[model samples]
Target: MRGSGQIVNRRRMIAGAGAAVLGTLLPGGAGAGRATDNALLPKLTDGRHWRIGYAETMPYGNYAGTLASIVKGLDALSWLNGAARMPYDAGQTDSQALWRWLSAHDLGPRIRFVADGWYGGLDQAPAEPILQRLESGGDIDLMIVMGTIAGRKLAVDRHSVPTLVFSTTNAVAAGIVAAAEQSGRDHVWAHVDPQRYYRQLRIFHETFGFRRLGIAYENSPAGRAIASIADIEAMAGQLGYELVARHVQAPAGPDDQERYYADLAAAWSDLAQRVDAMYITFGRWSLDRFPALVRVFQERGIPTFSQLGPEEVAQGALMSVARGDFDGIGQFGASVIARLANGERLADMRQIYFDTPTIAWNLAVASRMGYRPAMSALLAADNIYTSLRAVP
Candidate 1:
């Protein structure tokens, strides 16, 4: 459940060309150096005040928490790094709301905020407002987008402001760029190792014996980037488990949450003939509905495996194997954008992400599903988290 104080922000864009021009008008340039640099000294370029826009999608899953942490990290960087200012209200929900907050606020030249594009309605964050603002006096040097919520493919517009894509998936596959090593002159994707997903699969095999795997993913570039289950099909092949990947679209309505549960139950129930156990994905929809699926797993007598991250572990996810630190991703994004804000050419900069897998086990879920693994496995369990349903 999202906490009471957890806040979100979003924006929209209309015509791409218009938005590009608007971006160019803004201060799409700032200076940022390595994390070790002295906050007082400039490492790359001496750019003052950062003009930045944040685009984060898929906040519905266990993702809201990460946004909160990112805000905290950005705040820390602003003070310690002697960084430029960031745009917007600390917790306001929209660009207009943020603008209202900024008008009377005293953020100084060190901050510039565009807006988060996720929270707004479709096409609501019209790009020209940004472009006009830039033309009229915008100082945002870089825009950080989480996942390609941008929908269509976007190329680098040297004539306009450059965009730094932090899309969770590999930028290469999305055709965002020519290769992982190089995106456009301005755009580059942070690299996520395909091998990492494979490692998690191996861990799941250690627990579930690798039966037919049941995977679910929303049709989003970011969700697929984490684990396409296609690129790493070889992982399942090596484990000798039949792969049943279901591409789930977002629920049409709140009532459809039940349909999501039904769809998941059917994934395992229908495939139970072939798959003795299942691996649910960390997709936006699946990860958000974990507890429901956990109940389904218990009802069906199948062990479920997950590798999304630590937060899921706390929520009764059987296990999450990937490294996702919101603070780390935030700091990395801020530093890179800060560099862009400082007029860095953005060519060939290294991709950075925090990767540290923390395992969480719901002892009661394990026992309820009759998932008594090797005694040694149980003994070796780390962070045996308890669910309300867990055996006391």
Candidate 2:
């Protein structure tokens, strides 16, 4: 436990240094050691503020939180005046509302937040025409893609805009990138952590030693990627635990959110009856609805591990790897964008940045399961919620 904590701490220090030095330490960081261009420190080579665009598959808590972190990070890097704040709530499920907020935020003079650059929200039908305009008009200088669906759509070779992808489960598995080391397309860069989910599963298994672990997710390729199904299966094989899974429809259309949650609830209820533990996968379901789903597990005294992050753990899950304040990745992204503004090819820089995972444990949920954490485990948790937080 001490060794793991020391490693995580060392990685965090490296990440912090990398962010400050524009990821100079990262693999394939070609922009580093270039002649200093203080004149274009925050501006593009053409002496203009970079025009930034945004897109996502759908509204999700993580997307909103990640965006907020990026915006805050940019401010911290002096790209903004430190007055700009993300107007959209993390609990918001309306993508249009998010677009409106981004369009309206006072993002300072260093960044031109293209008001009309928003595309591919809940309804992807209109995204094609908008993407076509972006491809031909060349108005959007860079696009911040939030999910796997949007990453696949906008990070392709056909789209000329430099894309920075975030909030995806597995960028490589989702076909958003060639691999963690490089994005196949020059205009694409995605935050990749190939072993993130595997690490999460390993920690969960080490902590609980559950005989049968259950999971719920959509069964499609995207679904499998989102749930890290292959990783889970491998972990199950290695840990000698039975893997029980239930298929719940991932939202395909704008109106499918409610139905998806309904199916997810049913799946959780069923899994609660059969398995000793539950691994909640990333889904479009609102965080507000998680308490009821987690209640199913609590009723059965089943331990629940969230695949997302600490936010979900705060909501109800027993434990997860916490991304506290999102500072590491946020600064990593801000540095990448800064490099791009100063004339760096997106594909030439490394896309692999893993969070320094720390435990996020909910003592209330753990108590419900009658699980007592050892002194080391309790000391290791960075974010501990005594009770479930109120979701808005």
Candidate 3:
């Protein structure tokens, strides 16, 4: 693994383009490194602040949390990493870092944070309320939809403003857009990773030779669509393995939370004994239960894998294929929004997907599970954790 100093240098390099773009957007053209002429830059009409709305399927869940991190990362780039030096001690989640940056910086006067909403675990946020808040008065110029469910509904409802969908496992399968290359909607563009799961599964099989893989599936339309099990099944069959899956029920209300964890724990107990390894799917209910689920699998000596990111692997998963640069997503999304705000047609914009995937490994969990990844796998890991603690 690279030294701390090397990693920091790499991060700055990866953030260079983003920081430059953000510099052009800051007040008074402060950090405008290349383009000093204000006329050449994009700006809101009449100096009106650009209002961006944030919507997620499960705002408090892991996927949403990661999306929030991407936003903070953008804020850091906007300020040339000045927000990172702020004295405030942000929480572990990206949402906290975003809150801190918003409080400490003058980003609001030029770029404002608008309506924030989340569809409950059951995909209950209908189109009317979303459209009413965003499209009714033209209060919001752009909306960032976090997951497939929220993006699907917003697209189906025909939101009038430009929309950027992020972190969706599969936009094509969910019918958010006709094809990744061509987003059938003029007002929407999305970032989709259709092969994330396939890549992770292939890596796990080649690394550990896990034949019977166990997974927890959420019972929801979005869950059914994104990361379809049929895809996993076909991949597993070709790879000479079997997929053992259990349907996990989504919590209908607050009272069902405890029961939901209990049911997941029970399922994990049975699955651990049968499967050689475990794969976690993108489900709000399943993700919420990760801490408990990771503990259960760890205790049973089962190596767990996921496509979520490095954070999950650090928490307890044996390994993961994570999005290489978290900040890059925010940077790219910001550029798209900047163009749209500058009168560029949304139909002319193409959807973006992260092609750089990094391997992350948790040596502590691998040791506990009595599994040794091949030397090649270890050498390929971009991020490695020796302890089962959150990545700071």
Candidate 4:
């Protein structure tokens, strides 16, 4: 039998060896006479320096995390200054801070960040102007789009600019891409893990054996994608658990964010009365409210799993499955960007990539629920929090 270390090494070899392995399979790759001397450096096909722009659904921690990791990956690949670091915390939901950092940072001679090009919250920002900028093509060589709303808007046939979509809950379900194998648009590529939520739900169910599971999400199309309701329902059918779901109004504006959370608070409070366990889905609510949000679940001794990541677990959720670090996903995305800049066709490149999952367990939250995890489970956790962080 193969050792656990052997299995892990094999997975890394399959997933993390992104550039070399993928290049061989795709068109205009190493075998197709693609240039390599300047491949790691960012440049346009016409020998002009690359200028990159960015867009997002809103100010989100996941976007911040994905951007930071991509920047770090580019630096490591020598495409940017390895000595520099992004200024904002990936755990914070501040897009302006990230834009300021990008504007000031020396990203190296190979690429330039268009200072006026960053946009946030597609729901609030007018889509036409953003679409026009991307369609111009000469304004920026590539657009780093984060989140489902922006991805759907920017990654259409109407705009021919190279667009890379990241940080979405499920890109395929959101209709940002056609499928995991291909993006179905010439200038679009998305990083996707179609089964990520399914894996999370399965892990949660197997651990706690909950007879009824609860979830909350917005009722709209975008909200369903974020909550992964289809995946949740499919898992329920297989695992023999009843699903209890609630819909809270999605914030209409920045000012409405508080009301949205209030609605969520009420929904979860109602759910707490009916469910065996709760699955906390993603929303734009400020992380500060996490402690209070999970307080109802804790008061009732219900186990909660956060869909966002271990960051939420650190705040208050009981457990989650997360990549041990963002490095692997970052490297995967960076390789795709570098290759695209090097003149590889986005259509030829593969879009499916999966992070090797590790358990993130919070001992304090578990203790509060009067649950003691198995010794083997405790030993397997990649991140174990002894206490919850103070609410920000």
Residue-level lDDT of model 3, residues 38-154, one tens digit each, is 322456557676666666665433444445544554454342234454433211333434544544556544566652433333255456787777657467776777777777777
The local lDDT score (0 to 100) that residue 151 gets in candidate 1 is 19
**Which segments of model 1 are wrong by more than 4 Å?**
1-34, 38-48, 60-108, 115-140, 148-160, 167-170, 217-227, 246-265, 282-290, 310-316, 322-325, 373-384, 388-392
Candidate 4 vs. true structure, TM-score? 0.83
lDDT of 2 by residue, 1-392 (tens): 12111222223434444333322212232222222335225754454777888887766666776776676667776777643555655334455555666667666677877888776563244467757866785678888988877776777766677889998888998888888888887788998877788778877888888999998888999779767788888888888999899998777676777787788888889999999988888877766788776888986899999988776776788888765445567766777788787777878877777654567678888788888877556555666677754434
Instruction: Write candidate 4's Cα lDDT for 345-377 as tens digits.
Output: 888887767655666777788888888988656
Global fold similarity of model 2 (TM-score): 0.79
Better of 1 and 3 by TM-score: 3
TM-score comparison, 2 vs 3, better candidate: 2
The total of clashing pairs for model 4 equals 0
What would the TM-scores of all predictions be?
0.66, 0.79, 0.75, 0.83
Clashing pairs in 3: none
| TM-score attained by model 1 | 0.66
Q: Which candidate ranks first by TM-score, i.e. highest?
A: 4
lDDT of 1 by residue, 27-142 (tens): 23222233654432224334456555544443423233333344445556552322234343232234344333333445445664544322322112334444443344345455
What RMSD does each model have against the real structure?
11.9, 7.1, 8.1, 7.6
lDDT of each: 0.48, 0.72, 0.61, 0.76
Q: Count clashing residue pairs in model 1.
A: 33
